[model samples]
Every structure is written in structure tokens, then in C-alpha cells.
Target chain A: MEFRDAWAIASKDLRIELRSRILTNQIAPYTLLILVLFGFALDADTQTLRDTGPGLFWVAVLLIALLAIQRAVKIEDDDAAKERMLLTPVHSSSVFLGKAIALFIQLFVLEILLFFVMLALFDLSVEDPLLICVSAVLATIGVASSGTLYGVIAAGVGVRETLLPILLLPVLAPIAIGATRTFGDAFGRVDADGWAWFGLLSVFAVVYTVLGMLAYGQLMEDA
Target chain B: MNDVIDLQEAVVTLGQFPALTGVTLKVSQGEIVTVCGPNGAGKSTLLRLCAGLLPLREGSAHILGEDLQKNRRIIRQDVGLLGHRSGLYDDLTVEENVAFWGQMVRAESNEINEAIKLLGLDGRLRKVLVRQLSAGQRRRTSLAGLVVQRPLLWLLDEPHAALDSDGRDLVDGLIHEAAASGATIVLASHAPKDISSPSGRFVTLAGGRVTNDINNDGSGDGVS
Candidate 1:
């Protein structure tokens, strides 16, 4: 029943996003533009871009994740839909899982887009494509879970847009670090242990997912 | 004969200013009660309290046999609250919105369809997005969502606002029908007489408290 409710919510959110085209029309373009500009900032230096591409890719992903989280929270706030949903029999944990699932799907797709863009622009290549995929999935899960939790926490405040980044960015630092190092190993940009960083990413994802499922109900009540 | 709502000296504060102060009221099942008040009289707050959306700062509240302080969240599924906003997703069509909310409450597909038709949201309007809807249509859509829930308690704040004459009549019929079917209703409105049924109770509120609780049975007896 919980999974059913979560799927219902996820499908609802995805449907709305499909209709709105905000992800394709607005946020995607915005993140891609940021990535392109970073290439210019490096003066189109091949070695420089290649060496920094992984970090830059994660940065773009984080920005996109932030926008995605805000958009998720705004949809609920637009018509007091969250409050309305609360009155239903669906559990708040279901709501949290549903939203996180939706976010994960969206962020994963964008990460793929951003990855190919990095490949083309930064002259990047992957030594271990599977590791790259694993890192992306883990990092995306971490972002979605933690971002969903913090999104609701900051939702009730008036200054959420400015406040969200401040609250979300610092917490996402470990993801940025872990995913970057993992990606670096995949790209052969550095010789560090990518699987070790993958371990950290996995822990982050598991911890946040469990915490979100447990705490979402209380956070929503206060939010 | 059981009391569906029993609030005693309930104080609900919104950022330090008490929205509901010392409000004592009792509502039984199968009753249609209209609460009339000026702006900022806590009419909305009272309904929210009964809906278990607001916590009591002082005193006690029990809605549908559940102590609010002990378990407000548990009563939510059985309580329906319609506030000033339509609470319908603008991006979703009328039919989609109704179906979405209905599915949330595990309502049957037939119930969802029936509610849509009952609220006049079938036909072309069913596919129309809520954002494109007029104020009246949106209210009807919201009402359809509420109907699908089939809640034990209906807390409507300004239920007649933004509705046309026919829409208002439709709402009145629904409210009466709901009361007749044993669902307790507490509606707050500015023009209480406009929607007040002959058998309904009229409660006037001011300054976060009830000033008059009177029966419409022509007894002229009021509890102040």
C-alpha cells in the first residue's frame, strides 16, 4: 500500500512535469548553459577542461538537483496541494518516497545529458563506464533523498529560494566530493580508489533514504 | 447522539497571536452548522481545529472520537477541509484532479466518476485544466475532490464564495444531502442566511470566540 501510494504520487509528479516542460524548457537549458560557460572560463583549454570536467559535471548536477527540489516543493505549495494531500489517507513517508523517486528519475536523466555534454565539450572518455553509471545512481539517490527532506524543512519559510541553496549545498558537499572522485577514476583523470568513494556514496544514499522515510511525516506537519 | 466534535476553551495561536481563543463548541453527527463571523474572527481556524490541522495551544479537542492532542494525524483521513483556496492542482484537468485526489483516499473509480458528474465537471470541462477554469469551476472541482473522499466531517470555509447562483444551489444541495446521509458539516460563511438551512444551527463568532450559538428552530434561545 505504501509503495502503491508512492508510485501514484510519483506518476502524478512526472505527469505534471511532462505537461509543464519546465525541466526540458527551463532547468535543463539552464544547467547545460552553466556547463558550457565553464568550458569558456577555462579558455577552452583541453587539459584543463579534461582534468576539471568531473568536478564541473557534479557542480552542474548539484545545481540542477537544487532547482528540481525547489520545483517539487513549489508544485505542492502552488494550490496548497500538500496540505490537501495531507488530509488524505496516504502516509507522509509515502509522499516523501514518491517525491524522491520522481526527483531521482529526473536528476538521473539530466546527469546523463550533462555527461554526454561533458564528453563532447571537455574531450572526456570513460575507462570504466559501469563505475560511472553506479556513481551517478548513488549520487542521484543521495541528492534526491536529502534534497526532499530539506526541501520540506525550508518550504514553510518565505525566503525558500535563497534559503534552499544555503541549506542544500553544504549537505551535498560529500556527494559532490564522492561522485567527483569516483568520476575522476572512471575518466582516468586521477588514479585514486573510485570504489572507496563509491562506498561513501552508498552509505550517504542509504542513510538519507531511511532518515527521509522516518522523518518526513513530522517535517511535513511542521512545514 | 455522539459528539463528533468537542472543543473546550481551545486556543490556537498563529505566530503568537491567538487565532482561536477560548472557543468551546460541540457538534454532533448529521448536523449542518453554519459559522458566521467577521474577517479575522477565527472562523477558518475553528474549522481547521475540527479538521485536526491545527494543534490546541490550551484546552482540549476531540474530533471523531480521537483526542486531537494525542492523535491529530489519525483523524485526517476522515475529515475533509475546504479552505479559501480551491486546492486543486492547476496543471491537472478537472477529471485528472478529481481522480488523483480520489485515488489518494482509495476511492473507487465509480465514486470518482460520480463525483465529477455530480459537480458538473463532466463533458468538455472534465479535460480542462484547473488553471484555465473560472473561479466557480475550480470551486466545483475542489468540491468534487471532497465528495470522492466521503469524509465523516466536512469543514468548509466560505463554501459559497466564487460560486454562481446555480453553483451555490448545487453546493447547498450537496451540503444538505451530506447532512442527511449522516456526515457532520460545519461551514463558515460571511452571509450565513444565504446558505443557512431552516434546520441548521447558526453560530456567530467574533475575536476568536463564539458570541452566539443559536438553533434555527424558532425557539429564540441562544447560548452566549
Candidate 2:
């Protein structure tokens, strides 16, 4: 696939998202709501919240990532639009990569907002900003790649709403663990090995990306 | 003329229900073939099969000189399908939708502009969002995109739906023009009057099989 073709798909999706304001109006606010709900569920204990902030942040991300994937798929809800995309000469893998790239951008922005919210609400402080940033970037790629692959897999089913999370969450569990552990080390909350966790997240990112490219063409037809 | 679409006893199943049962069809290059049938008679399935969207479950299917089973992806690039849906992004303006599809097909900018102009969408409507346009307008935008791609095979499912008399005529003209330029067309429609071109062939499908195959001269065969 030509890189230009993939970027065109990605840019079109991102442009639509920007014009529609779905990400800003609905998804971002939903992520903020999740943080607040987490605060209430944890009983307003700043110490406890701070201790578990990284884990909770990732949890929030995982939940909101579902919304992002759904929105991405929804844009192609008109059957002919998807058929048109499939009929294009661009490789099917390019379509998958394009959507994954768009999702990664949305999630990255959401993470930044959530990170600030955590700092303000949970009184969390970052001890190693660079490490936290790197972990977030790597983990976001992992989430986006797996999320796009599963999103398309469940796109044809009537129970896609219930099925996407079931299919995606288990695949993303390793990402959650690795991201949380690395974030913990970045926050100076644990003496755990940070590079190893970052490495694990990186591996998840690369593996899922490669798998998505190889599997998307078959999935697009089968689904 | 070369055969662009050749399906010999092609069978397609949707779930357990057979949508196309041992269907044989041949469309030559630059020929215009219209499929007429009631709902559930598998007219749409025939178009999808030619576009390589539907898998051939039992028999041979070839389109644009490529075997459907082996070269579906490559065949898709040369084929353009316009189904029931308009396929335009609601959030994007008419121009943007056409430009987006043009980029996907790697069409030249002049060709894109020419297509949009040919569809008569070059005025203020070009800047209007697709969602805000009437159904006829949306259909025109989709046809413009199809025109820009300049596909070898055109599979249109109800190509005249939701269009005014003028828009319908425009579609017919486009079909005739495309066929004159050596582009094969297979369209499904309920209205026979809409596709009354003298050079066109008509095939009626019923119960997943061809019921009537009539030529422009009105001499043909009937299956049942």
C-alpha cells in the first residue's frame, strides 16, 4: 500500500471527527466522567486514589477506548461507504492502519486530558515525565491496533456493542498490566522494573500492528 | 468484444438461504445489461457478484478477465459499485466527498473536476454538506465519485432511486455514455421504463434464477 493512500484515509477520518466534534463533545467528557465516578467509588480518599491513580487512569482509558472504536466504525455505518473503501485499490492493511492511526491520535489526546485530571483531582505527581510519556505513547499504540482489529471483527454482528469489549478487553489486558506497571515506576510508587514493562508494552504494540495488517483483509471480507 | 463478466453456474449463499442458485451470465465489454426483478429475486446479488463483493460458493465466477476466487481484490479496483446507500460522508461537503474518493482511486485533479462538473454539482451545492443535501443531490455526488474513478465495470443497484426526472435522465445518459466508452454496466432496477435504451439487454430474475433473457431486438429465451 502506498503511504499516501493510508494517510489520506487517516486524514479524512480525523477531519470528520474534528468537524463533527464527537470526540470533544462526547468521548472526552465521558472519560472525565469516568475519572469522577472512580473518585466517588474510591470514597474520596486522596491517598488511596493517588496510590492507584495509574491503574485507574489505564482503566479509564480502556473504557473510553471502546467509545472511540465504536465511533470510528459508526462513521462507516452506511454499508456502501464501507463497500467503497473495500473496493479501493489501496491495500486493506492500509485501511486498518489508517483507522488505527486516527484512534491513536484521539486516545493520545484523551490521555493528556486524563493525566492532568489525575494530577488535579488525585493529587498525583509524576517523578519521571519522560518515562510516563513514553509508556503512554507505546501503550496507546497497542490499544489502538488491537481495538481497530477487534472493532472490524465485531462490526457485522448484531451484538457488536457487547461483543467488542469482550473481544478487545482480554487482548488489551497485557497492555493494561504493562502500562500500569510502567506508570507506577514513572510515578515513583514502586521499585518495579520499568524498562521491562515498557518493553512488554512495545512488544504488544508491534505484534498487534503486524497481526492487524495481516488479518484485516480477511476480516473485512468475512465480517 | 472481450467478455468482462462471465459467471457460469455461479452459486452464492447468504447464511443458509441461497441468494443465487446456479446463475449463468455473460456481459461483454462496453455492453449495457439491465437486471429487472421484484424484491428477493436476487437482482442485487447478481450485481454484487460481478463487483467481486459476493463470494462464489459453488461455481466459476470471473470479472474483468480475473477469476473472482483468486483475484477478487485486484478485480475490485477496476470495478465500481453504486448500491442503495449514497456512500458519501454526511460530515463532508459534496466537493470533499468527491475529492476523498478521487484520492482513494488516485485520480487526476482535472478528472475529478470534470466528473463533478459532468454531474452538474459544481455550483453552491458543491460546498454544502452531504447530510444537508436532498436524496437526489446525494445520489448525484455519489455518481460523480463513480465517474471520477472511471471504472471498467459499473454495478449499480437501483441507480435511479430517489432522483427526479432530470436526475434519472442524467443517470441514463451517464450509463449510455459509459457504455459507449467501453465501460460495462450491470444495473438492477424495478422500473423497466428507466432503462429503455435500444442497445441494452434485459434479464429478469425470479426465485434466484433467471426467468427471462431478452435482447434489444425482443428475441430471447425464458427459463420458466
Candidate 3:
């Protein structure tokens, strides 16, 4: 029942997102624009661009994930859909899982697109393709779980737009640093143990995922 | 007779302002109770409290035999609340919104389809997104969603607002039908005469308290 409820909520959110085209027309374009602007800022300095590619890639993903989280929050807040859901038999943890699943799907897809863009614009190539894939998977989960949790926390506040970044970015520093280091190793730019950083990303994903499930019920009631 | 709602001197504060102050009301099963009041008279707050969405700072509330102070969350599944907003997702089609909400309570496919048709949303409007719907259409869709829940207690706030005459009549009919089927309804409306039937009772609110409660049929005390 819990799994079904989670899927129902996730499907509803994904359907709304697809129909609205906010991710495609607005968020996706905006993310690509950030990368394009970065490309221009670097002035075609191939070595510098290649060296900083991993950091820039994760940075873009983190920034874009914020937009995606805000969009997720708005879909519920608008029209009082959240209140209606509160009246349903669905568990609050199910709601959190559903939202996190939707965010995971979206961020994973966005990361794929950003990866290709990094390859093309930054002239970056993958040496350990397996490491890159694993890093992206783990990092996306970590971001989506943590982002969905923080998104709802900020949503209850009147000044959500300004509050989300202030609350989220600091918490996501580990994902930023860990993903960047792992990606740098995957890109053969750094001579570090990528699996060691991958372990950190894995732990972050599990911790936040569990925390979100436990804390969501209380947070949703307050929200 | 089973008491569906037994609230006594319930005080609910939103931030600093007291929204519901000393509101004592009781509603029995299969009763159609209409709450009437001006703005800020605590009508909506009363409905929300009955729906188990608010905590009482003072006094007591028991809905569907569950003490709200002990467990307001558990009673929510059996309670349906249709607030000022339709609670419909704007980007979703009418059919999608109704079906999604219906599925939340595990409403059968037949129940969902029946609700959509009953609300007059089965044909062209079914595919139209709620954002594109007129106010009346959205209200009808919202009503359909509520009906699909098949809740024990219906908490409707301004259920007739933005509805056309036919839509209003449809809601009135639904409320009567729900009451006849043993469902308790506590609806708050400014225009009470339109929604409350001859047998329904009217409970007036003023300054966060019940000013008067009388049966429209002028027979028994409103509680019974």
C-alpha cells in the first residue's frame, strides 16, 4: 500500500511536470544556459576548462536541482493540493518517498544531459566510465533526498525563494565536494581513489534518505 | 445516535490571532449541519477543526469517536475537507485530478467514473486541464474529487461559491444524498438557504463562537 501510494504521488508529479514543460522549456534551458555562459567565461582556455570540468558540472547540477526542488514544492503548495493530500490515507513518509523518487528521476536525467554538455563544451573525456556512472547515481540520490527534505522545510516559510538556497546549499556541500572529486578521478584529471569519495556519496545518500523518511511526517504537518 | 462531531469550547489560534474561540458544537451522524457566518467569524476554522486539521489550544474535540487531541492525524482519512480552493491540480486534466484523488483512498474504478459523471465532467471537460477550466467547472471537479473519497465526515467550506445555479443544485443534491446515506456533513456557507435543505440545521457563528443553532424544519433541537 505504501509503495502504491508513493508511485501514485510520483506519477502525478511527473505527469504535471511533463504537461507543464517547465523542466523542458524553462529549467532545462536555464541549466544549459548556465553551462554555456561558463564556457564563454573560460574563453576557450582548454586546459583550465578541462581541469575545472568536474567542479563546474556538479555545480551546475546542484544549482539546477534547486530549481527542480522549488518546482516540486510549488506544484503542491499551489491550489492547496498539499492540504488535500493531508486528508488522504496516504502516509507522510510515502509522500516523502514519492517526491524523492520524482526528484531522483528528474535529476538523473538532467545530470545525463549536463554530462554530455560537459564533454562537448569543456573538452572533457571519461577514463573510468563505470566510476562516472556510479558517482552520478549515488550523487543524484543524495541530492534528491536532501533537496526534497529541505524544499519542504523552506516551503512553509513566507520567503521560500531566498530561504531554500540558504538552507540547502550548505547541506549539499558534501555532495558538491564528493561528486567533484569522484568525477575528477573519473575524468582522469586527478590521481585520487574515486571509490573512497564514492563511499562518502553513498553514505550521504543512505543517511538523507532515511532521515527524510523519518522526519517527513512531522515536517509535513508543520508545513 | 452517534455523535460525529463533539467540540466544546474549542480555541484554535493561528499564530497570535485566535481563529476559533470557545466554539461549542455537536453534530450527529446522518445530519446535514450548515454553518453560517461573516468573514473571520470562525466558520472555516470550525470546519477545519472538525476535519482534524487544527489543534485546540483549549477545550475538547472528538470527531468520529477519536479524541482530536490524542490523535487528529488518524481521523483525517475518514474526513474530507473542501476548502475555498478547489484543491485540484492546475496542470492535471479534470479526469486525472478526480482519478488521482479518488485513488488516494483506493476508490474503485467504478466509483471514480461514477463521481466524474455525476459532477458533469465525463465528456469534453474530462480531458481539459484544470487551469483551463472555468470557476464553475473547477468547483464541479472539486466536488467530484470529494465524492470519490466517500468520507464519513464531509467538511465543506463555501461549497457553492463560484458554482453556477446548476452546479449549486448539484452540490445541494449531493449533500442531501450524502446525509441520506448516513454520512455526516458540516458545511460552512455564507448563503445557507441555498445549500441547507428543509430538514438540515443551521448553526450561526459570530466572533468565533456559535451564536445560534436551529433546525430549518423547526422541529427538534439542532443536535438531535
Candidate 4:
């Protein structure tokens, strides 16, 4: 697969997202609202909230990742755009990579915002900055790869709206656990086994990316 | 000359319904073929099959000498399809939509501009978003993208659907031009009379089967 073809697809998606401002105007605000709602629901002391902020941050990430995938898939919903991409000479794996990359970048930006929001809202402090950054990057890759794979899988199904969450949530459980635990280790709220959790997140990201590249062609046939 | 499309008793089933029930047809290089039928008569299915969009359920199907069942991915590069949908992103301007597909095919910038000129969208209209354009304008943008690809085979399903008289004339001209340049054309339409090319062949499909096949020379055969 030509890297240029993949870049073309990724650039096109990113440009569309930038022009529409859908992620910033709608999804990002919704994610922040989730963080605010969690704060209200916790209604705990600063120490308790700080201890729990890492877990809540990941919860918000998982939910917002769903919206990101949905928007990515919806861009192809009109005018048989997905078929147009599939019909190109470029390998189907490249198309999958391009979409996964785009979603990763969007989620990356969202995570940065959420990280700052968590810092302010819960009075949290990063004890291990490097571990937090690495964990967030690895975890975002994991979510984007798996989310894109399942997004296309469900895109053509009749029950796609219901099917996407059903297919994605179970698969995302591992990433959620690994990310939250890694964050805990970074913030010194738990024993420093940050490397082990980061390793798990990396494994999830690599496995899902390879799986998506291998399965994309077959999925296009049915999608 | 090599056969651009060769399907022998091709069967395509959509769920419980058979969209194409054993359709056998052949078209050589540089031939303009028109497929006309009612809504459920599978006119669109035949074009899609040629474009490698639909799976062949039974019988042999080959496009550009590549087996449809096995080499679908390879066959797709040699074919361009213009279906019911315009395939243009509403958020993208006319130029961006055309350039995106042009880049996909790696067409040169000049070639892309030439295609846009053919569709008469090279001026102020090119900067307008697709959602803001009229249906005919969107269709023109879709055609421009297809033109940039310059595939060996063109599968046009209702290419004249949302066009005005001038745009319809443009579609006819494009078909002839593409065919003259050795590109095989298979156009599906409910109203075949609008396509008035003298050198074209007409194949009438009914209930997913070809009922009549007529050549430009007026010689014809009935398919059972």
C-alpha cells in the first residue's frame, strides 16, 4: 500500500472535520459536560475526587471516542463515499489506516483537553508526567484502531446505532482498565506498575491495528 | 479486440430477491452500451456488477479480463462508476471534492482541470460547497471526478437523472468522447431515449433478464 494514498485519505477526512468544526463545536463540549456531570455526581472531598479523577477521565474518553467514530463513519454515509474509497487502486488496509489515524488525532486532541479539565475540576496533579503522556498516547491508539474497525463493521448493519456500542464497549474494556490503572500509577495513588499497564495498552493498540488492516478488505465486501 | 465485460449467466441475489437472475451479456472495447428497464428490473445491478460493486452469486463474470469473484479489487482500478448518489462530500467545495478523487487516482493537476472544464465547472462554481450547489451541479462534479480517473470501463447508472437539458447534452457528449477514446461504456437509465448516440447499443432488461439486444447497425437478437 502506498503511504501517499493513506495520507490522502487521512488528509481529506481531517480537512472535512476542520471545515465542519463538528468535533470542536459539538463532541468536545459534550465530553466536557460529561466531566462536569461526573464532578457533580461525585460531590466528594478534594482528596477523594483527586483519587477518582483518573478513572472518570477514562470513562469520559471512552464515551467521546464513540462520538468520534460515529462522525468518522457518518462522513462516508452520503453518496456511497466508502464504496468510492474501496474502489480505488490503493490497498484496503491503507484506507483502514487512514481512518484510524484520523480518529487517533481527533481523540488525541480530545484527551489533551480532558487532561487539563481533570486537572482543574478535580484538583488533580500529575506525579509522573511521562507515564501519563505515554499512557494517553497508547490508550488513544488502542481506542481509535478498535473503534474504526468496529465502526466499519457496524456501518452497513441494519442495527448499526445499537450494534456499534454493543461491539465496541466489550472490546474497549481492556483499554479502559489499562488506561485507568496506568493513570493511577502515574498520579501515585497506586503502586508504580505503570510500565505493565502501558505494555497492556500497547499490546491492545498493535493487535487491533493489525487486525483492522487484515480484515478491512473483507469488511468492505459486506459493508 | 478484447471484451471489456463478459458475463455468462451471472446471478446476483440481494437477500431473498434475485436482482440479476442469470444475465449473460458481452461488450467489446470502445462500445457504448445502454441498459434500460423499470425500477426493479435490475438496471442498476448490472452496472454495479460491471463496476465490481456487487458479488456474483452464480456463473462466470469477468471485467477487463479479470475474474469478478477473485480479482474484484484489481478490476475496480480499471472501472469508474457513477451511481445514483453524486459521491461528493457536502462539506467540501466542488474543487476539493474533485481534487480529492483526482489525488486518489494520482491524476496530474492539468488533467484534473481539463476534466473540470469538460463539466463546465472550472470557474466560480468550483469554489462553492457541494451542499450549496444544485443537484445538476453536484452531478457534474461527480462526473468530473470520474473523468480524472479515466478508467478503461465506465459504469454510469442514471447519469442523466438530475440534469437539465444542457447537462443531459453534456452526459451524451461525454459518453461519446469516452468511447471514442477506447473506453467501454455501460449506462443504465429509465429513459433511454434521452441517450441518442447513433453508434451505441441498446439492451433492454426485464425482471433481471435481458429481453432484447440491439446493435447500432439495427441487427438484434432476443435473449431467452
Top TM-score hit: 1
C-alpha lDDT of candidate 2 relative to the true structure: 0.90
What is the TM-score of chain A, computed separately for every candidate? 0.99, 0.97, 0.98, 0.97
Per-candidate TM-scores read 0.99, 0.98, 0.98, 0.98
Question: Which digits, one per residue and each the tens of the lDDT, describe model 2 over residues A48-75?
Answer: 8988889999999999999999988888
Write one digit per residue (lDDT tens) for candidate 4, span B1-224: 89999999999988889999999999999998999988899998898888888889999999999999999889999899998987779899999999999998889999999999999998899899998999899999999999999999999999998899999999999998999999999999888888777787899999999999998678889676
Worst lDDT run of 10 residues, candidate 1 chain B, spans: B215-224
True contacts kept of 3: 0.80
Question: How big is the positional error of residue A36 in model 2, measured in Å on the Cα after superposition?
Answer: 1.6
lDDT string for model 1 (A5-46, tens) is: 999899989989888899999998998999999999999999
lDDT of each: 0.93, 0.90, 0.91, 0.90
Interface RMSD of each: 0.8, 1.2, 0.7, 1.0
| Model 4: lDDT of residue B74 | 93
Off by over 4 Å in 4: none
Steric clash pairs (candidate 4):
none
Best by DockQ: 3
lDDT of 3 by residue, B1-224 (tens): 99999988899999999998898888999999999989999999898888877778999999999999998888998999989988889999999999999989899999999999999999899899999999989989998999999999999999989988889889999999999999999999998888757678899899898888988877544431
DockQ in order = 0.82, 0.75, 0.87, 0.74
DockQ of 1: 0.82
Local accuracy of candidate 4 as per-residue lDDT tens digits, A110-202:
999989988999888788999999999999999999999999999989878788998999999999899989999998887759889899999
Runs of candidate 2 with Cα error greater than 4 angstroms are none
Tell how far residue A46 is off in model 2, in angstroms.
Answer: 1.6
**lDDT by residue for model 2 (B191-222), tens:** 86788778889999998888888887888777
